[model samples]
Target: MPSMKNSSFYPSYFLLVGIPGLEHEHIWISIPFCITYAFALFGNLMVMFVILVSPRLHQPMFIFLSMLAGNDGLLCTSFTPKILSVFWFNDRAISFTGCLLQMFFIHSFTSIESGFLLSMAYDRYIAIYNPLRYSSIITSRLILRLVIVFLVRAVVLVGPCLILIKRFPAFKTNIIRHSYCEHMAVVKLADADTHVNSILGLLVAFTILGVDLLLILLSYTMIFNAVFRLPSARLKTFNTCTPHICVFLSFYGMALFSFLSHRYGKKIPPSIHIIFSDIYLLVPPMLNPLIYGIKTSLIREEMGKILWKH
Candidate 1:
């Protein structure tokens, strides 16, 4: 067995390595990581700014986009700073309680993101298919309720993993491979049977991603059916839904890659998993807003106006 670093059964802190097998490249890796984090922050903020300031973008579709952008910002901000610190400064030690908090935030935000994506799909359905009727139906109260419901659902689903992990008596090591406190990675350090931990983590992940994906697909199916029946509306609908489709693919694609790589890709290199995990954390936040900015003309125009004003 490997030598442990902490005092008793519980470790005071867990040490994070930026990436396994890529320690020598930490400096170089930090370059792109920092750039991507900056862009993600800037882009999400820009999306929110555009949506909030532009009267033309006050519709449900853009409202949902702005909400999604805000969640993306929260999601990435929750974990990326720790990673950059580990890479650039070698400050990798995170307290046991801190680790649990990080895990909870990461998982909860991810689940909320999944919920928001589904919400966006529904918003698209309503906006495209029943825009006039929803003009009076979609209220700020309803939007706030959606956000609160997802937050509660995320907390309920992910909060227990930490509770269950706390019952772990001992660990073989205090070191974790990934830079952030991933539930599975941390659970893997435990010396006891972690089947419950693994099961719960996977279950929560698949439940959020799988169910959300299915519902989004169903929503889009209804959307496309409605869009296709109208000959003139087909092109406009496709153009409008293009960004949503792209974002859905990119976000869920990166998620599945990370989740599947973590669980089933034992034969793959550890560094590859770590890299993809980092990308999974970074890419959607970084790219989602870009996708919308490029695809949605209203956002782009408003963004240009804001930049010019600044």
Candidate 2:
């Protein structure tokens, strides 16, 4: 363990650059970000409201959808407010502890969201392939257990990275180039050896995200095989999966782009990286609920009822 007694080892604060090379345009950039954040909050909350109040949506699929909405809300809330503050008020100073807390919540919610997507894939698989056993296999109790498991896994995996960061002798600088406190971004600023931290972070990413993605793909493959055999229900099954597929692709596609660009796209402009990094967090939360609302008949109906009542 590194010496915590060394006064220089720990940083008191960090400066977040809202978007590198676009300082002059921050006010303009905030307009879209604000809109997206509001939409994400409203849309996800509406999804949760519909599911909670409407007993008809107590099915496994809708239950999972509610979980996704909740995760989206948390995910968006984790960093959007601070980023917006930076853009609007030019307040970029964040305490070191505050940054760590934000990093933990952001990454943990991301992992949880990925886990929820995997669970939703399984839900779709069972509903399409084994409709008879779907209810029995995917109960409220089971959903609760899965939620606990995902939350625990995220915390356990991310907690150690924080510890590792704390052990570093010092950071090269207190400036984080990105809008948020991502693990790698913060780690790269450290003056000490970061081999363990980097390797551990990569391992965690692969173990959680890589495994969830593989399982999701496998589940979908099995679902498609079963769907193809059913001539009468093939179209219905495909339609049911459209929203899930869309959300999955939107979330993972942006995530992969951001990850690859950060690690490998050295020649890419900093502005491009900054923009995509923000988009990766913003797009999924904003789009997931909208896709579900438009594509899901139950949610649309509930929304219609609410609108009429209002």
TM accuracy, model 1 = 0.94
| lDDT on C-alpha atoms for all candidate structures | 0.87, 0.90
Mind giving the per-residue lDDT tens digits that candidate 1 earns over 173-258? 89988879988889888878999888888788778888999999999998888888766755575678889899999989998888
Worst 10 residues of 2 by lDDT: 1-10
The clash number for model 2 is 0
Q: Write the per-residue lDDT of candidate 2 for residues 1-310, one digit (tens) a residue.
A: 1113233455788889878999999999999999999999999999999999888888889989998999999999999999999999989989889999999999899999999999999989988888888889989899999999999999999999998987788877788889999898899889888899999999998988889999999998998898878777556866889999999999999988888998899999988898898899888999999999999998899888878998
**lDDT of the structure predicted as candidate 1:** 0.87
**Candidate 1, which segments miss by more than 4 Å at Cα?**
1-8
TM-score of each: 0.94, 0.95
The residue-level lDDT of candidate 1 at 29 comes to 94
The whole-model C-alpha lDDT of candidate 2 against the native structure comes to 0.90
